[model samples]
Target: DIKPIEQLNINNLINKRNFRGIFGTQPPLSILEEIDYIIVSPGVPFDIPIILKAIEENIEVISEIELSYRLSNGKIIAITGTNGKTTTTSMVGEIFKESRKDSYAVGNIGLPMISKIDYSTNETSFIVEVSSFQLEGIKEFHPHISAVLNITPDHLNRHKTMENYIDQKSRVFLNQTPNDITILNKDNPITFSFKDKTPGKVILFSRLSTLEKGVFIEDNQIIIRNEEKERLLVCPVSDIKILGGHNLENALAAVAISYYAGIPIQSIRKALKKFKGVAHRIERVDIISGVEFINDSKGTNPESSIKAIEAMEKPIILIAGGMDKGSDLSEFVLSFKNKVRYLILLGETANIIENLARGQGINNIKKVASMEEAVLFSFNIANKGDVVLLSPGCASWDMYSSYEERGNIFKSLVKDLRR
Candidate 1:
């Protein structure tokens, strides 16, 4: 049975070509007779009653990316991680565009792979940014080049365990052969462990130490050494405009993915210089009364927010808390030491985070009802040279539709602070 969730636009759902008016709130306990195959979206948990019923009955269960991969003939450069997927995917997309290749960036970078399949040819290239949710249901979704940026605790509410989440993220390289490439981050322990497991050739990227054959920073220049031991200098680290140590990792992953995909060095260099970053990720919104405001509303988990907190140079008046995703916030609360001056909490997880902070001996916290109150509370407490960061460390589903909507609302409120 089809379940087009009620929260979405009904008009848009009905307008789909050849869409039959067949939707239900819940599936029958037994789907064996009528349903032979079920294509589940990433948003829906695989353990849901209907999908579990399909599995129990031996019905084929797959994801949209798996279906698109079966139908499309294009080369796929798929990247997945707890964070940095969007930035790396878009950076690789821009690098391909510089090469004048017939390529599209899809799969969670705002577009679905199936939608772009109709126009793709054998020569087409698809740079896909996949989430663990999207990767969880895959059976045969393979990419020509796959990169796992870093693994962290996210979507624990759905996956139920970090082990399962890591396995799902690793599935991006599940179908690869010896000819394909798997790029991994050396600094991230879980990601680096995959180097030995992958059948395909492995490429490593690091910010800490030099690699025998991978990408590394040498004398402040971004350099890559392939399996053939050929060294190529792409650009200086200064050429990268994106802030934070995490984004540097993203740039390294993008370079490895794009360069291995046969994109020219000149094109990669030019693209690296031109691409700033995707929105809602540590994006600087504005400054009011010498206090800066940043839109990191995309920081929907503790690890992501931790990175945002580390990226800031000035004292922070942080606005955090939203729909709890079952993440451990002890590290998030502990990191506030000497960094976060005031904590403005909102949404469903407000009390949870507040309690965690208080337990950590952090008492400079305020709980608010809405984004407006959070923004105003932060502004009132922020001083000159201090930054007001909106890194929620929780999903926006409790208060807003999406992270983008949350970020836009934060931006709108911050803009109004001037008035």
Candidate 2:
């Protein structure tokens, strides 16, 4: 131990493990002699002093995901995007479960990939939901199958530019060979541009149109065609229980990924029909006074929130705004033109979104300081059949530690309304 502490827990744990523990923000350079490679978590920025020092010292600095990838031995399917990554990853995991594969759904939405490495085997399947931050430090980390669901303007505050952000997301398929397969969103121009980027067999999924070879919706049914132009129908659009066209894309992605992995068509259909959805992304909470409450806290970006706004069938009493990530929310505001009845905003970007909404000639906006207030105001103004949606078009860092935390709090508040 290098620093004195009042608590014995951390010190005792360090002593019990018989390892050195440095408790300060900055460590002395003398300690560097024993340190070989520096492991960075996805949350840790590379520009920090210690990480920069490690880089300068020619030490191998890598993200925990990269380390996990190096140690993980399984048929890995890595999914990354600005949105729908969680849903898509979870869907793929469900498909694997139906097929009875010894699989683990780990990464951003579940356990850390590193934690599951010890449990992973040659026969195991790891459905990893990777983020741009996790992709930052990957060296030889490659997945057997990789999918970039869609690329949108997100995390610009960290990457500084759209190009750099895409660059990191692109890393998911960087080390794949021709033997591997990569699923790209054919409808997404940015992800579609990756058609020429990978050596892996490009499997495209589309909701708008049919593709020559890949997964697509045809005659309102999910279909896949191989290189030989042979078509296979998985299931009908009505079979999927998840809401939204965006979720339909996610379902198509899951099919593309699992079908390529050799899952039976029946198993794929079974999973698709049975798969509900992940929490915090357009999740139905409870209804009070005939008003529907939806938690779409996973809509951490404007593009994502736009989809959530579009997904609703009822007149929306939209609750949005969170930590500003310097995104163009004009489209976000514009999407609420005829759909959203009233807006209750909160968090850092509340004023910014409010001004944008007003500039667009919409004045039915209420600004609140907390989620409880946002929910109450929405409920107060909401009538029978109006949807109160908490689809924040920004990150949760302004108020909560994570989107899950923000969504949980909103759910708690909504459920409390019944009390």
Candidate 3:
């Protein structure tokens, strides 16, 4: 009297460690009726029929993040946004380390948070880079300090609507109380509008505006004003190694979060000056034939790719396109038209991007089926002072294991070219 699992085979059940016995087809009515909990993977859509069925059956559904949160005793400082999450999370972890605290940065930055869980101590802190998919299925996944850096139009294909996407991102603060801190990007209109959404104490970080309680840049100094004390922590912005106005905002967010987590001002300053950045996010590879090659494979959204393009001082041979996540590439058209001297489109979104470029009257666009072809094409067209940048404004899942793998390939190809 067992029902079978639908759309899944024996291997799937075995891989999932479902030892209750999986039938070839839908399980028997008796087995289906007794089901209690359903764990959904990030790859499984929330709107899936099986999830709806589970809900109808009064079964509890949860994500891996929820499970991790339940088991973790460490102070969690979770980061989420369409972009810059990894860099900010890494920077915050560095700040904690500089303060001589036991801290580890993990999670969606490709290292699982569960893998870093130390059973030995209760003093360790975790800085996790979370995603919307991970946030979507949570039940009680609350972090001690949560920061939504910024949210743009992204992952629409999975969420099916922008509102749903924003709702998912807001889950980062779902279970927090007033004692917890919620840091937000005040400059991001979308994140700013969510000010009334969370019940936790709000701390705002901005690059364009001043905040009474959070961090901001004013008169060339990075300022952290204490709303409770009316005191200030100030440092020069030039001390930060990461470039771009966007990164300035990221640094501000990290500083606010780490400062609240008990990291001293001097430790924060030391981390800011010494921390370079996370890999594959505007990562400079090498100068081949005098053309600088940057592997920014983590810029999977148009907003992030635009930031990478904006950070470029030299003329760029922009490598873009991948599995389209239903993001609007039109947002980057002006940046590409101005900064990019050549466009090398790759992966599933190539034709769509190429058409968009052509529609915009851009003629220097070229399509290549693989990264090697794209690199060679870029190298052929790149001048001595120009840069060949792999800042694909789409996901790398279509062609490689992960964004890191895609970035490594670009680095390897660029190194081979140098040799």
Residue pairs whose backbone atoms clash in candidate 3: 2-27, 2-28, 3-26, 3-27, 3-28, 4-25, 4-26, 4-27
TM-score of 3: 0.91
Which residue window of length 10 is worst by lDDT in model 3? 1-10
Per-residue lDDT of candidate 2, residues 261-353 (tens digit) = 989999999999998898998899998989999999999999999999999999999999999889988899999999999999898899999
- Per-residue lDDT tens digits of candidate 1, residues 155-232? 989989999988888898999999999999999999999998888899999999998998988999999998799889
Local distance difference test, each candidate: 0.90, 0.90, 0.85
TM-score versus the correct structure, for each prediction: 0.96, 0.95, 0.91
Question: Once superposed on the true structure, which residue ranges of model 3 sit more than 4 Å away at CA?
Answer: 1-36, 118-120, 229-231
Local accuracy of candidate 3 as per-residue lDDT tens digits, 1-419: 12345434356646788477545544444554767786666776767566777777878888877777778877888899988898998898888888889888888877777777655157988888999999987888879899999999998999989999999999999999999999989999989877899878999989997776788888888988886756575578898778688888889989999888988899999989998988998898898778999999998888999999999999999999998888888877667877889988989899888888888888998888899999888888888999998999999988986788899999999988866
Candidate 3 yields a Cα-based lDDT of 0.85
Deviation of model 2 at 182, angstroms: 1.2
Candidate 2: where is the Cα deviation over 4 Å?
A: 1-31
In model 1, which residue pairs have backbone atoms overlapping below 3 Å? none
